[model samples]
Target chain A: MDIRRLRYFVAVAEARSVGKAAERLRMAQPPLSVQIRKLESEIGAPLFRRGTRGMDLTEAGQALLARASEALALAADGIEAARAVAAGSRGRLSVGYMFVLANAMLPRLIPELRRSIPGVDLDFAELSASTREARLLDRSVTVALCMPAIHHPEIQVARIGAQPFMLAMPIRSPFARLGSVPMARLQGRPLIALPPPERDPSSSAVAALLRRHQIVMPIASRVETVHSAMSLVLAGEGFGILPACARLGAPRGIVFRPLRDATDSIDIAVCWRRDSHSPLIRTFLKCAEKAVAPL
Target chain B: MDIRRLRYFVAVAEARSVGKAAERLRMAQPPLSVQIRKLESEIGAPLFRRGTRGMDLTEAGQALLARASEALALAADGIEAARAVAAGSRGRLSVGYMFVLANAMLPRLIPELRRSIPGVDLDFAELSASTREARLLDRSVTVALCMPAIHHPEIQVARIGAQPFMLAMPIRSPFARLGSVPMARLQGRPLIALPPPERDPSSSAVAALLRRHQIVMPIASRVETVHSAMSLVLAGEGFGILPACARLGAPRGIVFRPLRDATDSIDIAVCWRRDSHSPLIRTFLKCAEKAVAPL
Candidate 1:
C-alpha cells in the first residue's frame, strides 16, 4: 500500500473511532471511512470491528501498524540522505597534497573544514605536483595543495602561504655554529635540492633565488619531498635549502639557519579544477584561506 | 537540483556528446542541451568546454558528475526499500512460540518462510502460552504458536499440529522400563505440570485429559514452559506430561512413553490478530500449514 493509505489506517487504528480519526487527520468522516474501507477491501480483510463505544482492531490491523511506521521512516531517511548529498553537505571528499603542506597547512585546515561542514567525509593522500595535477584532472581527487601555483587553464589555484628559504645543516656541521649562513660562506658547497624545474615550479623558484645571489653550489643530491631532503641532510650528505615552515617540527639532529641574502620564498597554493561545482570544494578552499591567513 | 537533471548531466558527461546522450536517452538533442545549460546556470558554473571534437568537462562538471551519481543512487535505493516494505517482502517479523513447538513447527516453517519471502527478517522468541497471547495482543510479537484454541473474537487461530500426550520420566525410574505407562499406575504420584488451567489453556487441556482417564495425581510443582517441566523430571522431582515433539530432542536421562489410556491430544494453533494485513503474517501462516501437514 502507499504511504498515504498506511497513514490513514494508522490514524484510524490509534483513534479507534472513524469520527475521531477524521478529526485528528483534519478531514471529514465520510472520506476517511471510505479510505479505511478501501484499504480493508484491498487487503481482503476486515481491519476493525465497530463497537457501540468505538472501534477495535482485527488481527490484520495490528500487523500493518508495526510495518507501516518502519516503512515511512525508511522512506524519509532516504530522501534526507539524498538531499544532503545533492547539497554537498555530505558524502566523501578525496584530497591530495604535498608532504610538507601537512605540517604547515593541513593541521589548521582539516579541523576547520570538519567543524564547518561536519557531514562531509574527508580522505587525504600525499602526492607530488605532477601526480596531484593528474589526479585532479581525472577526478580521483577533489582538491590539491601544491607548490609555485599551477598555470593550467582548467585548473584554479589560490595562494595559501609563502615561506622564506632557510638553510638546513647537520648539527655537527661547521655552518651549524653560525647564527645565520651568508650566501658567500662556501662558493662550491654541496646542496640538496628538490625535483628539477620542469616537474616542480617550486624547485625552479629556489634555483632562481640562488642564481640572483650569484652563489655557486654543486648539487649533492635530488629528492622529491622536503622530508626526504631533511633525511639526506641528517646523514651529512649535504646541507639543504627548504621553506621556513619545515623548521617547526624538524628532528633534533638538524639545525635551521636563515639565509642572509635570500630574497625569494617558496609559494604554496590550493588547486582544484576551475569548473568544480561542489560546495564541499568551495568550503574547503575557504578553510584553506583561513588557515594560511596568519602564515 | 532534481534527479532528472542530474541524470541528464551524467549522461552527457559520460557520452561526451550532447547528440550521443540524447540518442542514448531516446530523446531530442536540443532539449537535452537546454537541460545541461540550465543545470550549469543553476550551479553558477560552466560545466563543459564546447570544443570542435565534442563537449569536455570543465572542473566544476567533473565534481558534479561524481556527486550526482551518488545522490541519484541513494534516492533510488530509498524508493526501492520503501516499495519492498510496502509489499511485505521486506522488514522484520517477530514470532513468539512455546518451547515444544520449536521441535515440531519452527524447523520446517522458518526455512520455508525465508525461501518464500526472502526479504522478511524472521525473529523467533520462545514464550509461554500466556506471554505469547499477551505479546500478540500488545503487538510486541507479530504472530504466536500456542496450545488449545484462543477464544478471542479478534484473534485468528489456525490449527498447526496435534501431539498426543507423552509421559516423561527419569531413565532410572521404574516407569521408564514400561513400554507405555498405564493411566492408573500413577495414582497419588507427584506430577510436574505447566501453569494451572486458569493461566494456560494447554494446561487445562491436559487436566481435562487426565480427568477423562480417571487418573488423579498430586501436583509436585507448576512451571511456565515445557523445558522447565523437563528439568523437574530430570531432577527426579516428578514425572511430567509433555507433547510428543518433546521426545525428538530429549536428553538421555529422560524417556518419553505414550500414555496407555490417553485419548485426547494437545492442539497447537498459530495465532495472530485477525485484522493483520501484513504479508509476513500471511506468509508465515502458509509456512505453518506446510510444516504441520506430515504430522
Candidate 2:
C-alpha cells in the first residue's frame, strides 16, 4: 500500500468517522472516504463496516492497522536517521594521531569534541610516519593530527599549532645545566634521530634546519619513532632533537631544553582527504584548531 | 533531503555531466542544473568546483554523494520490505498445535507452509488444552490447531478435519477381540478422562454425549492432557476415550478400537484471533484445509 493511503486509513480508524478524520487532516471528508475505499480494494478486503452507531473495523482492518502503523513508523525513523547523518550531528569519526602527540592532543581534543559534536562516536588510531597519509586517503581515519605536515596532491593540510624543536639530553650532562643550548654548540654532537619518512625525505627537514645553523651531528643511532629517541637520550647514548610536545611524558632522566638559536619549529597540523566533504571532518577541523591554539 | 532529489543527484554524479544525466533521467538539462544548484544552496556548500574536467566533485559534494545514495537505497528497501510483509510473503508466523495434534498435524502442515510462503519465519508452540485459547488471543501464536473447536466471542475457528472417538485399552481386553466396540459396553466402565478446560467445561461435553446412550463412566482418574490419558490406558489402569488420530505413535501395550454406534467425532479446528488480517494466517488456513482433507 502507498504510505499516503496508509496514513489516511490510520486517521479514519482512529477517528472512527471520515468527517472527524477530515477535520483533523484539514481536508474534505469525501476524498478521505474515497482513499479508504481505494485501500480496501487494494488489499481485497473490507476494512470497515457501518455499525448502528458509526464506522467499525473488520477483522482484516484490525490486522492491517498494527502493521500499517509499524511501516509508517519505520519510514519516519529512516528519514530522521539520514537527516542526523547529513547534518553531521550523528555519525562515527575516526581520528588518527602520531603516537608522540596522543597524550598532548587527545587530552585537550577529546574535551573539545564532547563540547561540540557530542552525538558522534569517536575511534582513535596511532599513525606512524608512514601510515598517516595512506590511512587518510583510504578513509581508515577521518582526520589526522601530525607534525611537520605531510605533502601530497590528494591530501589537504591545515596548520593548527606549532612548537619549536627541543634538545633532549641526560639530566647529568653539562648541556642540561646550560638551561638553553645555542644551535652552534651542538656541532659534532652524537644524536639519536628519527629516520626519513618512508616515501618522502622532506619531513626530515629538521636536519636541513640544523644545517642552516652550521651544526653537523653524527647519527648515534636511528629510530622509527620519537619515543625511541627519548629512550636513547635517557640511556645517555646521545642527545636527541624532538618536538617540544614530546616533553609531555619524557623519561625522568631525560631533560628537554629549548634550542635558543633555532628559528624553525615543528608544525602541528590537521589533515584529511581532499575530496571529502564530511560534516564531521569539518566540525573536527574546527575543534582541532581550538584544541592546540595555545601551543 | 527528499528521496526524489537524491535520485537526481546520484544520476548526475555517475553521468558526470548534466546534459547526459538529463538524457538518462528523461528531463531537460536546464531543470536538472537548477535542481543541482538548489541542493548545493540547501547544503550551504559548493558541491562542484569547475575544472578542465567535466563536473568535478568538491570535498562537500563527495561526502553528500555517499550519504544521499545510501538514503535513497534504504528508502527503496524499506518500501519493498513493507510490501512483502503486507502481501504475506515475508515475516514471522508462530503456529500453535496441541501436543496430541503435533504428530498428526505439523508433519503435513509444515510442508504446506514451506511451499506456500517460503520467506516467512515460523515458530511452533505446543499448547496444552488450557493455553491454546489464551495464546491465540494474546498473539503469542498466530494460529492454533485445536480439538473440538474452542468457542469464544473473540476467536474464529474453522473445522478442517474430524475423527470418531476410539477406545484405548490393554491389548488383552476381551473387547480387543470384537471388530469394533459398542457404545453400550462402555456403560459403568472405569474411565480415564481429560480434565475440563480452565474457564469452560463444555469440551467435557463428551461425558454428556455418553449420557445420551445410558453410559455413566465412573471416573477412574482425571488427567491434564490426551497424552497422559494414553499413558494410563497403556498401563492398564483404566480404559480411555481418545480420537482415532491418537492411534498414531501409541504405546505397544494399548489397542485402539472405534465406537460402532457413535454419531459424534472430535473436530480438528484451526483458530486465530478474530481481529487478525494476516495474509500468512490466511495462507496457513488454506494449507490446513488441504492437509487433513483425506481424514
For every model in order, what is the number of clashing pairs? 16, 1
How much lDDT does candidate 1 score?
A: 0.78
Give the per-residue lDDT digits (tens) of candidate 1, residues B183-278: 888888899988765645445877887777777878999888788889899999998988888877677799998889787788878888875667
- Residue-level lDDT of model 1, residues A27-92, one tens digit each, is 999999999888777666666877798888754465566555554454444344544655777667
Cα error, candidate 1, residue A172 (Å): 3.1
Output the number of the lDDT-best candidate: 2
**Residue pair clashes in candidate 2:** A277-B59
lDDT of 2 at B151: 81
DockQ of each: 0.07, 0.06
